[model samples]
Target: MESSAAKYCCDNINNHGSSSQSQTSTCMQKFRLYETRSNFYMIGRDKSRTYWRVLKIDRLDPSELNIREDSTTYTESECSELLRRIHEGNISTGGLRFVTICYGIVGFIKFLGPYYMLLITKRRQIGSIRGHNVYAVSKTEMIPVPNATVNSSIADSKDENRYKKLLCTVDLTKDFFFSYSYHVMLSLQKNLCNNEPGQFLYETMFVWNEFLTRGIRGHLQNTLWTVALVYGFFKQATLSVSGRDFKLTLIARRSRHYAGTR
Candidate 1:
Protein backbone atom coordinates (compact mmCIF):
# COMPACT_ATOMS: atom_id res chain seq x y z
CA MET A 1 0.00 0.00 0.00
CA GLU A 2 2.82 2.37 0.86
CA SER A 3 4.54 1.67 -2.42
CA SER A 4 1.34 2.22 -4.35
CA ALA A 5 0.63 5.44 -2.54
CA ALA A 6 4.19 6.62 -3.00
CA LYS A 7 4.11 5.83 -6.67
CA TYR A 8 0.85 7.69 -7.11
CA CYS A 9 2.26 10.71 -5.35
CA CYS A 10 5.46 10.64 -7.33
CA ASP A 11 3.57 10.29 -10.59
CA ASN A 12 1.44 13.32 -9.79
CA ILE A 13 4.54 15.29 -8.89
CA ASN A 14 6.21 14.12 -12.05
CA ASN A 15 3.22 15.37 -14.01
CA HIS A 16 3.45 18.61 -11.98
CA GLY A 17 -0.28 18.40 -11.32
CA SER A 18 -2.74 17.51 -14.07
CA SER A 19 -4.50 20.88 -14.07
CA SER A 20 -1.43 22.85 -15.08
CA GLN A 21 -2.30 24.77 -18.28
CA SER A 22 1.18 24.30 -19.64
CA GLN A 23 0.87 20.51 -19.74
CA THR A 24 -2.11 20.76 -22.05
CA SER A 25 -0.06 22.65 -24.60
CA THR A 26 2.54 19.89 -24.61
CA CYS A 27 -0.03 17.10 -24.37
CA MET A 28 0.43 16.40 -28.03
CA GLN A 29 4.05 17.31 -28.77
CA LYS A 30 3.88 16.41 -32.44
CA PHE A 31 0.98 14.84 -34.33
CA ARG A 32 0.16 13.32 -37.67
CA LEU A 33 -3.23 13.42 -39.33
CA TYR A 34 -4.58 10.67 -41.52
CA GLU A 35 -7.87 9.95 -43.22
CA THR A 36 -9.52 6.98 -44.79
CA ARG A 37 -12.59 6.74 -46.97
CA SER A 38 -14.50 5.89 -43.81
CA ASN A 39 -12.67 7.71 -41.03
CA PHE A 40 -10.26 10.48 -40.02
CA TYR A 41 -7.35 9.84 -37.70
CA MET A 42 -5.13 12.08 -35.58
CA ILE A 43 -1.98 10.59 -34.11
CA GLY A 44 -0.46 12.73 -31.38
CA ARG A 45 2.73 12.80 -29.34
CA ASP A 46 3.58 14.16 -25.95
CA LYS A 47 6.21 16.84 -25.45
CA SER A 48 8.77 14.05 -25.15
CA ARG A 49 7.57 12.61 -28.46
CA THR A 50 8.48 9.18 -27.01
CA TYR A 51 4.78 8.84 -26.18
CA TRP A 52 2.08 8.54 -28.81
CA ARG A 53 -1.71 8.89 -28.93
CA VAL A 54 -4.22 8.13 -31.63
CA LEU A 55 -7.68 9.67 -31.66
CA LYS A 56 -10.66 9.76 -34.04
CA ILE A 57 -12.94 12.62 -34.79
CA ASP A 58 -16.67 12.11 -34.81
CA ARG A 59 -19.27 14.21 -36.57
CA LEU A 60 -22.49 14.24 -34.61
CA ASP A 61 -25.37 16.58 -34.06
CA PRO A 62 -25.15 18.87 -31.05
CA SER A 63 -28.18 17.14 -29.58
CA GLU A 64 -26.34 13.83 -29.74
CA LEU A 65 -23.80 15.16 -27.28
CA ASN A 66 -26.23 14.29 -24.51
CA ILE A 67 -25.56 10.69 -23.53
CA ARG A 68 -28.88 10.23 -21.76
CA GLU A 69 -31.12 9.55 -24.72
CA ASP A 70 -30.69 6.25 -26.51
CA SER A 71 -32.52 7.37 -29.63
CA THR A 72 -29.78 9.78 -30.71
CA THR A 73 -28.00 7.72 -33.33
CA TYR A 74 -26.27 8.91 -36.49
CA THR A 75 -26.29 7.02 -39.75
CA GLU A 76 -23.11 6.51 -41.81
CA SER A 77 -24.06 9.15 -44.37
CA GLU A 78 -24.69 11.72 -41.66
CA CYS A 79 -21.38 10.91 -39.97
CA SER A 80 -19.53 11.37 -43.24
CA GLU A 81 -21.31 14.60 -44.03
CA LEU A 82 -20.26 15.94 -40.65
CA LEU A 83 -16.67 14.92 -41.22
CA ARG A 84 -16.77 16.39 -44.68
CA ARG A 85 -17.93 19.78 -43.43
CA ILE A 86 -15.30 19.81 -40.67
CA HIS A 87 -12.13 19.35 -42.74
CA GLU A 88 -13.58 21.29 -45.65
CA GLY A 89 -14.16 24.21 -43.36
CA ASN A 90 -10.71 23.67 -41.83
CA ILE A 91 -12.19 24.06 -38.34
CA SER A 92 -9.88 23.06 -35.56
CA THR A 93 -9.61 23.39 -31.81
CA GLY A 94 -6.16 24.91 -32.43
CA GLY A 95 -4.47 24.75 -29.00
CA LEU A 96 -6.87 23.99 -26.24
CA ARG A 97 -6.68 21.57 -23.30
CA PHE A 98 -9.61 19.80 -24.90
CA VAL A 99 -9.45 17.60 -27.98
CA THR A 100 -12.32 17.85 -30.41
CA ILE A 101 -11.70 14.20 -31.28
CA CYS A 102 -11.53 11.02 -29.19
CA TYR A 103 -8.47 8.90 -28.39
CA GLY A 104 -9.61 5.27 -28.27
CA ILE A 105 -12.54 3.15 -27.27
CA VAL A 106 -11.58 1.47 -24.00
CA GLY A 107 -15.28 1.65 -22.97
CA PHE A 108 -17.82 3.57 -20.91
CA ILE A 109 -20.24 2.81 -18.13
CA LYS A 110 -23.80 4.00 -17.47
CA PHE A 111 -24.60 5.64 -14.19
CA LEU A 112 -27.59 7.33 -12.52
CA GLY A 113 -26.24 10.85 -12.06
CA PRO A 114 -24.60 11.73 -15.37
CA TYR A 115 -22.78 10.27 -18.37
CA TYR A 116 -19.13 10.13 -17.34
CA MET A 117 -16.34 9.97 -19.88
CA LEU A 118 -13.01 8.53 -18.74
CA LEU A 119 -10.13 10.10 -20.64
CA ILE A 120 -6.45 9.41 -20.34
CA THR A 121 -4.72 12.60 -19.25
CA LYS A 122 -1.14 11.40 -19.10
CA ARG A 123 0.64 8.07 -19.47
CA ARG A 124 3.98 7.04 -17.91
CA GLN A 125 6.31 4.40 -19.30
CA ILE A 126 7.43 1.81 -16.82
CA GLY A 127 10.71 0.24 -18.09
CA SER A 128 11.63 -2.09 -20.94
CA ILE A 129 14.24 -4.43 -19.49
CA ARG A 130 12.79 -7.20 -21.64
CA GLY A 131 13.37 -5.24 -24.85
CA HIS A 132 9.78 -4.01 -24.72
CA ASN A 133 8.30 -0.89 -23.18
CA VAL A 134 5.23 -0.85 -20.92
CA TYR A 135 3.17 2.16 -19.94
CA ALA A 136 1.01 2.88 -16.89
CA VAL A 137 -1.85 5.34 -16.67
CA SER A 138 -0.23 8.32 -15.08
CA LYS A 139 -3.27 10.59 -15.12
CA THR A 140 -6.87 10.82 -16.30
CA GLU A 141 -9.61 13.40 -16.53
CA MET A 142 -13.37 12.92 -16.11
CA ILE A 143 -15.74 14.87 -18.32
CA PRO A 144 -19.49 14.68 -17.85
CA VAL A 145 -21.44 14.34 -21.06
CA PRO A 146 -24.59 16.09 -19.93
CA ASN A 147 -28.07 15.22 -21.04
CA ALA A 148 -30.81 17.64 -22.33
CA THR A 149 -30.66 19.62 -19.16
CA VAL A 150 -30.95 19.29 -15.43
CA ASN A 151 -33.40 21.22 -13.30
CA SER A 152 -31.92 24.69 -13.26
CA SER A 153 -34.97 26.15 -11.60
CA ILE A 154 -34.36 28.65 -8.83
CA ALA A 155 -36.78 26.62 -6.72
CA ASP A 156 -34.83 23.40 -7.22
CA SER A 157 -34.01 21.58 -4.02
CA LYS A 158 -30.53 21.39 -2.49
CA ASP A 159 -30.26 17.76 -3.64
CA GLU A 160 -29.02 18.95 -7.06
CA ASN A 161 -25.99 20.58 -5.51
CA ARG A 162 -25.38 17.53 -3.32
CA TYR A 163 -25.45 15.23 -6.32
CA LYS A 164 -22.86 17.31 -8.14
CA LYS A 165 -20.74 17.36 -5.00
CA LEU A 166 -20.83 13.57 -4.77
CA LEU A 167 -19.43 13.21 -8.25
CA CYS A 168 -16.87 15.96 -7.77
CA THR A 169 -15.71 14.48 -4.48
CA VAL A 170 -14.13 11.55 -6.23
CA ASP A 171 -10.31 11.77 -6.17
CA LEU A 172 -9.52 9.84 -9.34
CA THR A 173 -5.79 9.50 -8.52
CA LYS A 174 -6.56 7.82 -5.19
CA ASP A 175 -10.04 6.42 -5.60
CA PHE A 176 -9.91 5.19 -9.21
CA PHE A 177 -6.82 3.48 -10.57
CA PHE A 178 -5.82 2.28 -14.03
CA SER A 179 -2.73 0.95 -15.76
CA TYR A 180 -2.32 0.14 -19.41
CA SER A 181 0.63 -2.06 -18.34
CA TYR A 182 -0.40 -4.43 -15.52
CA HIS A 183 -3.32 -5.53 -13.42
CA VAL A 184 -2.63 -3.66 -10.23
CA MET A 185 -4.91 -5.27 -7.69
CA LEU A 186 -7.23 -2.92 -5.85
CA SER A 187 -6.76 -4.54 -2.48
CA LEU A 188 -5.72 -7.83 -0.91
CA GLN A 189 -9.31 -8.60 -0.02
CA LYS A 190 -10.44 -7.74 -3.52
CA ASN A 191 -7.74 -9.94 -5.02
CA LEU A 192 -9.11 -12.88 -3.07
CA CYS A 193 -12.66 -11.88 -3.86
CA ASN A 194 -14.62 -13.53 -6.61
CA ASN A 195 -16.17 -11.12 -9.07
CA GLU A 196 -19.86 -10.72 -9.76
CA PRO A 197 -21.23 -9.92 -13.21
CA GLY A 198 -20.52 -6.41 -14.62
CA GLN A 199 -17.83 -5.71 -12.06
CA PHE A 200 -14.24 -4.53 -12.50
CA LEU A 201 -12.92 -7.83 -13.82
CA TYR A 202 -10.00 -7.37 -16.16
CA GLU A 203 -11.56 -9.05 -19.17
CA THR A 204 -15.12 -7.92 -18.53
CA MET A 205 -17.16 -6.35 -21.30
CA PHE A 206 -19.81 -4.16 -19.65
CA VAL A 207 -17.23 -1.63 -18.49
CA TRP A 208 -17.26 -0.27 -22.02
CA ASN A 209 -20.86 -1.23 -22.78
CA GLU A 210 -21.71 1.62 -25.11
CA PHE A 211 -22.74 1.75 -28.74
CA LEU A 212 -21.12 5.06 -29.54
CA THR A 213 -17.61 3.85 -30.29
CA ARG A 214 -15.04 5.92 -32.17
CA GLY A 215 -11.32 6.78 -32.30
CA ILE A 216 -8.36 4.33 -32.35
CA ARG A 217 -10.71 1.37 -31.87
CA GLY A 218 -10.22 0.32 -35.45
CA HIS A 219 -10.71 -3.02 -37.14
CA LEU A 220 -7.69 -4.12 -35.08
CA GLN A 221 -7.93 -2.31 -31.78
CA ASN A 222 -5.07 -3.75 -29.74
CA THR A 223 -3.66 -0.79 -27.81
CA LEU A 224 -4.34 -2.45 -24.47
CA TRP A 225 -2.01 -5.25 -25.54
CA THR A 226 0.88 -2.81 -25.23
CA VAL A 227 0.71 -2.94 -21.44
CA ALA A 228 1.40 -6.65 -21.04
CA LEU A 229 4.92 -8.14 -21.00
CA VAL A 230 4.81 -11.76 -22.20
CA TYR A 231 7.87 -13.72 -20.97
CA GLY A 232 10.44 -11.42 -19.46
CA PHE A 233 10.58 -13.58 -16.35
CA PHE A 234 12.69 -16.32 -17.99
CA LYS A 235 16.37 -15.50 -18.03
CA GLN A 236 18.57 -16.69 -20.86
CA ALA A 237 22.25 -17.74 -20.64
CA THR A 238 24.78 -19.57 -22.84
CA LEU A 239 26.81 -22.54 -21.65
CA SER A 240 29.43 -24.96 -23.05
CA VAL A 241 28.16 -28.54 -23.24
CA SER A 242 30.64 -31.11 -24.58
CA GLY A 243 32.60 -28.12 -25.98
CA ARG A 244 29.53 -26.95 -27.90
CA ASP A 245 27.67 -23.74 -27.17
CA PHE A 246 24.09 -24.24 -26.04
CA LYS A 247 21.08 -21.95 -25.69
CA LEU A 248 17.99 -22.61 -23.55
CA THR A 249 14.37 -22.22 -24.59
CA LEU A 250 11.29 -21.96 -22.41
CA ILE A 251 7.73 -21.73 -23.71
CA ALA A 252 4.98 -20.08 -21.69
CA ARG A 253 1.22 -19.83 -22.13
CA ARG A 254 -0.03 -16.42 -21.13
CA SER A 255 -3.19 -16.06 -19.08
CA ARG A 256 -6.20 -14.86 -20.99
CA HIS A 257 -7.35 -12.53 -18.26
CA TYR A 258 -4.03 -10.76 -17.59
CA ALA A 259 -1.51 -12.15 -20.03
CA GLY A 260 1.38 -9.69 -20.23
CA THR A 261 2.94 -9.96 -16.78
CA ARG A 262 4.71 -13.22 -15.94
Candidate 2:
Protein backbone atom coordinates (compact mmCIF):
# COMPACT_ATOMS: atom_id res chain seq x y z
CA MET A 1 0.00 0.00 0.00
CA GLU A 2 1.05 3.57 -0.58
CA SER A 3 2.27 5.41 2.49
CA SER A 4 -0.27 8.17 1.99
CA ALA A 5 -3.16 5.72 1.70
CA ALA A 6 -2.06 3.83 4.81
CA LYS A 7 -1.73 7.04 6.79
CA TYR A 8 -5.13 8.24 5.64
CA CYS A 9 -6.81 4.97 6.63
CA CYS A 10 -5.04 4.89 9.98
CA ASP A 11 -5.84 8.45 10.91
CA ASN A 12 -9.44 8.03 9.83
CA ILE A 13 -10.30 4.61 11.24
CA ASN A 14 -14.06 5.08 11.00
CA ASN A 15 -13.98 6.67 7.53
CA HIS A 16 -16.37 9.52 8.45
CA GLY A 17 -16.19 13.28 8.71
CA SER A 18 -17.86 16.15 10.59
CA SER A 19 -19.86 17.16 7.50
CA SER A 20 -21.32 15.42 4.49
CA GLN A 21 -19.13 17.15 1.92
CA SER A 22 -15.90 17.60 3.89
CA GLN A 23 -13.80 14.58 4.95
CA THR A 24 -12.09 14.81 8.35
CA SER A 25 -10.27 12.26 10.49
CA THR A 26 -12.03 10.29 13.21
CA CYS A 27 -9.52 7.66 14.30
CA MET A 28 -11.36 6.44 17.40
CA GLN A 29 -8.22 5.67 19.34
CA LYS A 30 -9.02 6.86 22.88
CA PHE A 31 -12.32 6.39 24.67
CA ARG A 32 -14.09 7.78 27.72
CA LEU A 33 -16.91 5.73 29.20
CA TYR A 34 -19.78 7.37 31.09
CA GLU A 35 -22.83 5.70 32.52
CA THR A 36 -26.29 6.58 33.74
CA ARG A 37 -28.83 4.28 35.38
CA SER A 38 -29.97 2.79 32.10
CA ASN A 39 -27.17 3.24 29.57
CA PHE A 40 -23.46 3.62 28.85
CA TYR A 41 -22.19 6.49 26.73
CA MET A 42 -18.78 5.84 25.16
CA ILE A 43 -17.05 8.86 23.68
CA GLY A 44 -14.22 8.12 21.23
CA ARG A 45 -11.74 10.50 19.62
CA ASP A 46 -8.77 10.44 17.30
CA LYS A 47 -5.17 10.90 18.41
CA SER A 48 -5.17 14.55 17.39
CA ARG A 49 -8.32 14.96 19.53
CA THR A 50 -10.04 16.94 16.80
CA TYR A 51 -12.71 14.41 15.80
CA TRP A 52 -15.19 12.64 18.04
CA ARG A 53 -18.11 10.16 18.00
CA VAL A 54 -20.44 8.46 20.48
CA LEU A 55 -21.61 4.88 21.16
CA LYS A 56 -24.59 4.06 23.32
CA ILE A 57 -24.86 0.75 25.16
CA ASP A 58 -28.19 -0.12 26.76
CA ARG A 59 -27.78 -1.45 30.28
CA LEU A 60 -31.40 -2.23 31.07
CA ASP A 61 -31.49 -5.63 29.38
CA PRO A 62 -29.21 -8.39 30.60
CA SER A 63 -29.89 -11.07 28.03
CA GLU A 64 -29.12 -9.08 24.85
CA LEU A 65 -26.51 -6.63 23.60
CA ASN A 66 -27.92 -3.29 22.55
CA ILE A 67 -25.44 -0.86 21.00
CA ARG A 68 -26.13 2.18 18.84
CA GLU A 69 -23.74 4.60 17.16
CA ASP A 70 -24.39 8.30 16.77
CA SER A 71 -24.12 9.32 13.11
CA THR A 72 -22.80 12.81 13.70
CA THR A 73 -19.14 13.65 14.28
CA TYR A 74 -18.47 16.39 16.82
CA THR A 75 -15.72 18.83 17.55
CA GLU A 76 -14.05 18.66 20.96
CA SER A 77 -16.13 21.42 22.48
CA GLU A 78 -19.33 20.15 20.95
CA CYS A 79 -18.62 16.65 22.23
CA SER A 80 -18.07 17.99 25.74
CA GLU A 81 -21.31 19.94 25.61
CA LEU A 82 -23.19 16.86 24.43
CA LEU A 83 -21.79 14.93 27.38
CA ARG A 84 -22.79 17.71 29.74
CA ARG A 85 -26.33 17.58 28.41
CA ILE A 86 -26.47 13.82 28.95
CA HIS A 87 -25.19 14.28 32.49
CA GLU A 88 -27.74 16.95 33.33
CA GLY A 89 -30.64 15.09 31.78
CA ASN A 90 -30.01 11.98 33.88
CA ILE A 91 -29.36 13.82 37.17
CA SER A 92 -32.43 12.43 38.90
CA THR A 93 -30.87 8.99 39.59
CA GLY A 94 -27.26 9.92 40.33
CA GLY A 95 -26.54 11.59 36.98
CA LEU A 96 -24.03 10.38 34.45
CA ARG A 97 -21.02 9.08 36.32
CA PHE A 98 -17.57 8.81 34.83
CA VAL A 99 -16.71 5.14 34.42
CA THR A 100 -13.17 4.68 33.07
CA ILE A 101 -10.83 5.59 30.26
CA CYS A 102 -10.04 2.75 27.87
CA TYR A 103 -7.96 2.33 24.74
CA GLY A 104 -10.36 0.01 22.90
CA ILE A 105 -13.17 -2.48 23.39
CA VAL A 106 -11.82 -6.04 23.60
CA GLY A 107 -15.33 -7.38 22.96
CA PHE A 108 -18.62 -8.30 24.71
CA ILE A 109 -19.24 -11.75 26.15
CA LYS A 110 -21.84 -13.43 28.33
CA PHE A 111 -22.37 -16.57 30.33
CA LEU A 112 -25.81 -17.64 31.56
CA GLY A 113 -27.21 -14.26 32.57
CA PRO A 114 -26.08 -10.72 31.76
CA TYR A 115 -23.54 -9.71 29.16
CA TYR A 116 -20.11 -8.33 30.07
CA MET A 117 -17.92 -5.91 28.15
CA LEU A 118 -14.18 -6.51 27.95
CA LEU A 119 -12.12 -3.32 27.74
CA ILE A 120 -8.43 -2.66 27.35
CA THR A 121 -7.77 -0.25 30.19
CA LYS A 122 -4.01 -0.04 29.70
CA ARG A 123 -1.58 -0.66 26.83
CA ARG A 124 2.18 -0.46 26.29
CA GLN A 125 3.98 0.00 23.01
CA ILE A 126 6.07 -3.02 22.05
CA GLY A 127 7.23 -2.23 18.51
CA SER A 128 6.36 -0.62 15.22
CA ILE A 129 6.22 -1.92 11.68
CA ARG A 130 6.28 0.51 8.74
CA GLY A 131 5.26 3.48 10.91
CA HIS A 132 2.37 1.61 12.48
CA ASN A 133 2.60 1.22 16.24
CA VAL A 134 1.91 -2.12 17.95
CA TYR A 135 0.95 -2.49 21.61
CA ALA A 136 0.49 -5.22 24.14
CA VAL A 137 -2.32 -5.37 26.61
CA SER A 138 -1.11 -4.17 30.01
CA LYS A 139 -4.41 -4.19 31.84
CA THR A 140 -8.02 -5.18 31.08
CA GLU A 141 -11.44 -5.11 32.72
CA MET A 142 -14.58 -7.24 32.36
CA ILE A 143 -17.56 -5.25 33.51
CA PRO A 144 -21.11 -6.49 33.56
CA VAL A 145 -23.39 -4.25 31.50
CA PRO A 146 -26.27 -4.43 33.96
CA ASN A 147 -25.80 -3.25 37.50
CA ALA A 148 -25.72 -5.65 40.42
CA THR A 149 -29.32 -4.96 41.31
CA VAL A 150 -30.62 -5.92 37.90
CA ASN A 151 -29.00 -9.36 37.73
CA SER A 152 -28.58 -10.02 41.43
CA SER A 153 -29.82 -13.59 41.44
CA ILE A 154 -27.94 -14.93 38.41
CA ALA A 155 -24.86 -12.82 39.07
CA ASP A 156 -24.31 -14.46 42.44
CA SER A 157 -24.82 -17.99 41.26
CA LYS A 158 -21.97 -20.48 41.67
CA ASP A 159 -21.96 -21.39 37.99
CA GLU A 160 -21.58 -17.79 36.96
CA ASN A 161 -18.60 -17.20 39.24
CA ARG A 162 -16.98 -20.38 37.99
CA TYR A 163 -17.39 -19.33 34.37
CA LYS A 164 -15.90 -15.94 35.10
CA LYS A 165 -12.95 -17.58 36.77
CA LEU A 166 -12.42 -19.87 33.81
CA LEU A 167 -12.29 -16.93 31.42
CA CYS A 168 -9.86 -15.07 33.65
CA THR A 169 -7.39 -17.92 33.49
CA VAL A 170 -6.59 -17.06 29.87
CA ASP A 171 -4.70 -13.92 31.05
CA LEU A 172 -4.97 -11.50 28.13
CA THR A 173 -2.02 -9.42 29.31
CA LYS A 174 0.46 -12.22 28.77
CA ASP A 175 1.00 -12.73 25.02
CA PHE A 176 -1.49 -10.62 23.11
CA PHE A 177 -0.87 -7.48 21.09
CA PHE A 178 -2.63 -5.34 18.47
CA SER A 179 -2.38 -2.28 16.27
CA TYR A 180 -5.16 0.16 15.57
CA SER A 181 -3.68 1.10 12.21
CA TYR A 182 -1.89 -1.99 10.95
CA HIS A 183 -3.25 -5.40 10.09
CA VAL A 184 -0.76 -7.43 12.14
CA MET A 185 -2.35 -10.78 11.40
CA LEU A 186 -1.53 -10.38 7.70
CA SER A 187 1.98 -10.94 6.45
CA LEU A 188 4.10 -7.90 5.67
CA GLN A 189 3.92 -8.55 1.93
CA LYS A 190 0.15 -9.00 1.98
CA ASN A 191 -0.38 -5.88 4.08
CA LEU A 192 1.67 -3.92 1.59
CA CYS A 193 0.15 -5.28 -1.59
CA ASN A 194 -3.45 -6.16 -0.73
CA ASN A 195 -6.28 -3.67 -0.41
CA GLU A 196 -8.88 -5.97 1.07
CA PRO A 197 -12.07 -4.78 2.68
CA GLY A 198 -11.79 -3.95 6.40
CA GLN A 199 -14.44 -6.56 7.18
CA PHE A 200 -12.32 -9.29 5.60
CA LEU A 201 -9.42 -8.50 7.92
CA TYR A 202 -11.58 -9.11 11.00
CA GLU A 203 -12.99 -12.32 9.57
CA THR A 204 -9.57 -13.91 9.17
CA MET A 205 -8.52 -16.90 11.25
CA PHE A 206 -5.88 -15.06 13.29
CA VAL A 207 -8.10 -12.48 14.96
CA TRP A 208 -8.91 -13.72 18.44
CA ASN A 209 -11.80 -11.31 18.92
CA GLU A 210 -13.62 -12.34 15.71
CA PHE A 211 -16.63 -13.91 17.37
CA LEU A 212 -16.72 -11.47 20.26
CA THR A 213 -16.88 -8.36 18.08
CA ARG A 214 -19.30 -9.76 15.49
CA GLY A 215 -22.43 -8.40 17.18
CA ILE A 216 -21.38 -4.78 17.39
CA ARG A 217 -19.69 -4.77 13.98
CA GLY A 218 -22.84 -6.21 12.42
CA HIS A 219 -25.05 -3.66 14.15
CA LEU A 220 -23.04 -0.53 13.34
CA GLN A 221 -21.56 -1.72 10.02
CA ASN A 222 -18.17 -0.47 11.16
CA THR A 223 -15.34 -1.27 13.62
CA LEU A 224 -14.92 2.05 15.34
CA TRP A 225 -15.25 0.75 18.90
CA THR A 226 -13.00 -2.33 19.10
CA VAL A 227 -9.54 -3.75 18.47
CA ALA A 228 -8.60 -7.15 17.07
CA LEU A 229 -6.01 -8.80 19.33
CA VAL A 230 -3.61 -11.49 18.05
CA TYR A 231 -2.49 -14.21 20.44
CA GLY A 232 0.88 -16.07 20.24
CA PHE A 233 4.34 -14.52 20.54
CA PHE A 234 6.53 -11.54 19.55
CA LYS A 235 10.18 -10.71 20.11
CA GLN A 236 12.84 -8.35 18.77
CA ALA A 237 16.58 -8.57 19.25
CA THR A 238 19.88 -7.22 18.03
CA LEU A 239 22.75 -9.60 17.26
CA SER A 240 26.32 -9.67 15.90
CA VAL A 241 26.96 -11.99 12.96
CA SER A 242 30.39 -12.15 11.23
CA GLY A 243 31.51 -9.03 13.10
CA ARG A 244 28.46 -7.11 11.81
CA ASP A 245 25.37 -6.10 13.72
CA PHE A 246 21.95 -7.34 12.65
CA LYS A 247 18.37 -6.95 13.86
CA LEU A 248 15.81 -9.73 13.99
CA THR A 249 12.12 -9.74 14.73
CA LEU A 250 10.01 -12.82 15.23
CA ILE A 251 6.24 -13.14 15.31
CA ALA A 252 4.35 -16.33 16.04
CA ARG A 253 0.59 -16.50 15.46
CA ARG A 254 -1.41 -19.28 17.08
CA SER A 255 -3.87 -21.18 14.96
CA ARG A 256 -7.31 -21.81 16.44
CA HIS A 257 -8.25 -24.64 14.11
CA TYR A 258 -5.86 -27.30 15.43
CA ALA A 259 -5.17 -25.97 18.89
CA GLY A 260 -5.15 -29.07 21.07
CA THR A 261 -4.05 -31.93 18.88
CA ARG A 262 -0.34 -31.13 18.66
Among all candidates shown, the one with the greatest TM-score: 2
Score each candidate by Cα lDDT.
Answer: 0.33, 0.78
Candidate 2 lands at a TM-score of 0.86
Error of 1 at 223 (Å): 6.2
Worst 10-residue lDDT window for candidate 1 reads 63-72
Global lDDT of model 2: 0.78
Model 1 residue 236 CA deviation (Å) reads 20
Candidate 1 collision pairs: 29-45, 107-208, 108-208
RMSD of each: 17.1, 8.5
The candidate that achieves the highest lDDT relative to the unseen native structure:
2
Clashes of 1: 3
Per residue, candidate 2 scores C-alpha lDDT tens digits across 192-219 of 9977755678888889888888887777
lDDT of 1 by residue, 45-124 (tens): 44344544333332222122211101112344543443344344333322112243322223332333433445545554
Count of clashing residue pairs in every prediction: 3, 1
Error in Å for residue 121 of model 1: 0.9
